[model samples]
Target: MLKFTLKRLGYMLVVLFIVVTITFFLVHSIPGDPITAMVQDLPEETRTVYLARYGFDQPLGVQYVRFIKACLCGNLGESLRYPGRKVIDIVRNYAPVSGVIGGLSLAIGFTIGILCGILAALNRNKWPDKLIMVIAILGTTIPTFVTAAVLQYLLTVTWPIFPTTGWGQAKHIVLPVLCMCVGPVATYARYMRSSVLDTVNQDYILTAEAKGVSQFRIVTRHIFRNSFLPCITMICSSIAGIFSGSFIIESIFAIPGLGKYFISAINDRDYSVVLGLNIIFTGIYILAMLLCDILMALTDPRIRYSNDR
Candidate 1:
């Protein structure tokens, strides 16, 4: 396990290097200089001084190397648009908001999805199953922004049950959470239903039944355990999906989160913030994948570490 973890860490580092390099070059290649954008209001002499102060007068390669070095030294560079604030400071302030919303949505979605799936599986070919299927289809088909807008209209605008925008109190989170939950819940339900159905039909399940094992024991202890493993992998991979969903939901709801910062960075062409946020998110994703692999090995004895396998 140690060796396997080390290998994965090495791979993650390599990927991070590639991502950083690509992002730096690509952002630099974008039309219109950030220095020009930042200094547009300044006189020509003042603009030249500002550019020199920020080292914008340096060659692109030198700038890239300095940026990489600064990042390595725990400095994500000062934001061009926001001047005195470091990119890292902005990220630190916003990440927690996104984390809270994303984490709550994921938990609620997964729990509801698993319960619904189990019920649908148990009631296959019946109305309950059909109803769940329709819900799953709708959840998967609708775009997240569309769902956010519609929910805002129905729950916030028309009925005024929830606040329309801005995140401060818990009340502000309700609509965004619901919107983020839609696709994940639907996807998880369908996956869980299929897994349960397949597990229930396995030969071991039949043998357990023939031996007169309690139905509850057979289903929960044996079948559910095996059935839920794949869902774990699916859930981990969906971390990226959850974050992406939060981007739209957060922006629409005016939540002060990484999503809002990300959108602002793009619009303002704040490359430091954009690159900093991207790297942070990519680190999170990689860490989640590693955790998923560890959890899989721990849960199923059959899943041996690479050395053991």
Candidate 2:
């Protein structure tokens, strides 16, 4: 187990380095200059000074080395557009908002998805099952941006029940969370339904049924637990997606999350922020995968024994 974990950590470091290197070069490869974007109409000499100030005048190799060094020392440098602000500080300010919304959305999604799946599976081929399946299909088919737009129109613009956009109030989170969760709920529901249906047909399930185990106990203990195993990996992977913030949802609602900042950084040619955020997101996903592996090992003895071997 220790060896496996150490190996995973090594792989994660390699992946993070690759992500950082790629993002650095890709951002630099884009047409035009960040300095020009920062100071639109600066005199040539002044632009030279600006470039020198940010180390942009240095050779690409030198800049890359310095950037890597700074990153190793936990400095992602200042935002090109925001001047005095550090990338880490900006991330700290925005990540919590995204985290809160993401956490809530995931909780809601998992709960609703599991319940709906169980209901549908138990009532297979009936109206209840059909209705849930239809809703799941619609949820999966609709785009998040469209969902956000429609919800905003119906709940905010027409009804005036919540604020149209912007952060601060608790009400601001509702629409975006709902919009984001729909897709996840649909996805999880389908997976859970299939898993449960398959589990129900297993010999052990038939044996349990013959033993006259109560329906609820059979479903929860015998079926749902086994069915839930497949979802652990999916749920862990989704954690990064949730915390990253849905770009469209954040933009539509003017939520000042990392996703909003990331988009702005790209458009404004703020390479520091863009590169830093990308690395952070990459680290998040890699870490989530590690957690998923650990979780799977804990839940399944087969995985644990295989690793032990």
Candidate 3:
């Protein structure tokens, strides 16, 4: 396991380098110059100052080398959109807001989804099963943004159960968290239901039943344990996706998250913020997949990972 983990860590560094390099070059290659665009209406002297401040005055190769060095030293550079702010500072400050909402959403979604799936599977082909499936279908089919809008309208506009916007308070988190939950719950429920059903039909389950093992023990010991192994991947994948995608929900609700800033940075051609955020997300994505692979190997005895590879 140690060797396997070390190998994955090495791969993670390689992937991070590739992601950072690609994002840096792509951002620089964008048509408009951030300094020129941001300061187009300001004084001519201001433009030159801004250019020098962000190293736009230097050649692209030099800038890339500096950016890489800064990243290695844990400095993400200064933001081009919000002057006088470091990119790392922005991430440090804003990440927690998104983190709170995303974490809560995942916990709720996973619990509700997995339980519902188990329930649906236990009642296979019955009314409960059919009803859960329908809910899962709707949740899977509906886009998150649309769900956010509809939820905002119903919860805020019509019912007035929660406020439409703002962060820093628990009430503000409810709507965004709820909106994010819709898709995850649907996905987990459907997948879990299938896993449970498949586990029930396995030879071991039949043997346990034939041996006069109680239904409850059989399910709790064997079925659920095996069925839930798949969810490790699902939950980790959601972690990668939710952090990146939370920007849209944050934008709609005015939540002031990294995603909210990310959108604005893109529009303003804020190279530092964009590149920093992209690298952060890409790292998270790669790390999550690595965790998924490790968790699967550890939890499921049937699978073995060879360190020699």
Best candidate, lDDT: 2
Which whole-number lDDT from 0 to 100 does residue 161 have in model 3?
95
Candidate 2: segments with Cα more than 4 A from true spot: 1-6, 37-42, 157-160
> What is the lDDT, from 0 to 100, of the residue 152 in candidate 1?
89
- Using TM-score, give the best candidate's number: 2
Task: Report, for every candidate in turn, its global Cα lDDT versus the true structure.
Answer: 0.83, 0.87, 0.86
Worst ten in a row by lDDT for model 3: 300-309
Better of 2 and 3 by lDDT: 2
Q: Tens digit of lDDT per residue, candidate 2, span 179-274?
A: 888988898888888888998999999899899999989998899878888989898878888668877888888888888888888888788888
- Lowest summed-lDDT stretch of 10 residues in model 2? 240-249
Ranking by lDDT: 2, 3, 1
**Cα distance off (Å), candidate 3, residue 112:** 1.1
Question: Worst 10-residue stretch by lDDT in candidate 1?
Answer: 238-247
